[model samples]
Target: MPDERTKYAWRKAILAARAQVSVAQHAREAAALAVAAATVAQPGNVVCAYVPMRTEPGDLAMLDALVVGGATVMLPVTGAPGPLSWARYLGPDSLRPARFGLLEPTSQALPPSTVAEASAILVPALGVDRRGVRLGRGAGYYDRSLGAADPDTKLIAVVRDDEFVDELPEEPHDRRMTWALTPGDGLQQLHV
Candidate 1:
């Protein structure tokens, strides 16, 4: 396990990285990049994502792109520590401020189990490494939700380019990512 200071270092690195790119620009570019890769790698119609909060990556543009691409989009809703709900992302109007300063669907009930049905899932990360180890908001939310995904689901971490690195400390029960999407690289599979 990483020491407390090392964990903070990783988080600090990501914060520094994101500050280099405009959030609006990076979101639009990264979404287009990941969507293209996901289209080729995944065949399922449903894509699940989490709404952005604080300094985490946002997928507002990504969700719009998915809809335009004729794919169904699902947004994760925070539930009990280990479970999450997935609601259809109808559009901007469908979202309202929710817990954690995030946005969520106000009119859909696709159920939390919908996460298991996704062909692809885009998650926010404070940092992630080539080994696919992700450092989230220390909530263990994704670690739990990912355990429920189908084995081949495209579990991607969206981050600024520098936050996606060559290595990160690994641990058992740490779910690996299938890819990392960034403004510069688009969709890059973890190979470190």
Candidate 2:
């Protein structure tokens, strides 16, 4: 296993690459990702997801697609950076700008434990390997919040096609993803 410093380097490199993505390419990937991600949103299912930030792989369209697909979408509400709280996503109109330049739902915030109700979680990742190791932005919010999810809940890491690699550094506390969702591959099951 690599140390935290290696993880830091990986995050920096991946983020730098993400920043260089062309605007046209980002739009194309976002459209494809929206279609691909919606496949996991079955009617009556509850999905825990996040609004992607600057240069993130997804956009609001992805969340809207999930809602249109009949899943009840819950978006993370940022606070003091432990486990994340959630709120139901009513629509694009329901969001208001919040901390970290994120758009959060204006609805009442639910406890962090509400993640346990999700059938699937669309987690943000800078990258994910075939073995399901996820490289996040080092906040540890998702890692801590995911602890409340049921063991059977599908943990899917959302990343761009090129960000899916063969290996990444992992720590004991890092939650392994069950699947990777990309614009090109859609949902590929990982070898957890």
Candidate 3:
């Protein structure tokens, strides 16, 4: 398990790197991410995904792709911040500005347990290692919310191509992802 200091250091460095992405490159990557994401969304399946804020990678395009691919999409609703609640994603127009510079669904808030209904979960990450450990923004929201997902659900870390690495620090409570979805690479199964 990684200590708090190590985790914090990694988070800082990773976020700094992500922040350096140019606006043009980011837009291209976001489009690629959307196309890649669509491939994983099965028809009639529920997909739990997040809307990208700032330079976090992937945009509403990713959510739209899932919808176009015939999957029902849900986005996280920020609440008190331990675990994220959920809301059905109607379309781009359904989003409203929320806390922490995020865009959340304007629909009814569903409990965190709603993740169990998803066949695939598109998790945002700063990085993901070869071993399947995901590095998030240090919020711990996904760690808590993902605990309620079905064990069979495909937990996928969504990142830029270079953000997928050989290793990342892991803690006991961290959830392991079985796949990584990157803009350039698309989806790849991980050996957790």
Clashing pairs in 2: none
* Cα-based RMSD of candidate 1: 3.3
RMSD of each: 3.3, 2.2, 2.5
Q: What residue runs in model 3 are displaced by over 4 Å at the alpha carbon? A: 1-5
Report the lDDT tens digits of candidate 1 across residue range 39-143.
523334878876666556545666677677766788887766776777888998899887778788986666556888888888888878888888776777788
**How many times do residue backbones clash in model 1?**
0
**TM-score for model 3?**
0.95
lDDT of 2 by residue, 1-192 (tens): 233448888788788888899999999999999999889899999999999889999899999999999999999999997999999999889999999899999999999999999999999999999999999988999999999999999999999998898889899999999999999989999999
Residue 79's lDDT in candidate 2: 95
Model 3 root mean square deviation, Cα atoms? 2.5
Ranking by TM-score: 2, 3, 1
Q: Which candidate number maximizes lDDT? A: 2
Report how far residue 161 has shifted in candidate 1, in Å: 0.9
- Residue 38 lDDT in candidate 1: 48
* TM per candidate: 0.83, 0.96, 0.95
Ranking by lDDT: 2, 3, 1
Candidate 2 ranges with C-alpha deviation above 4 Å: 1-5
Winner on lDDT between 1 and 2 is 2
- Best candidate, TM-score: 2
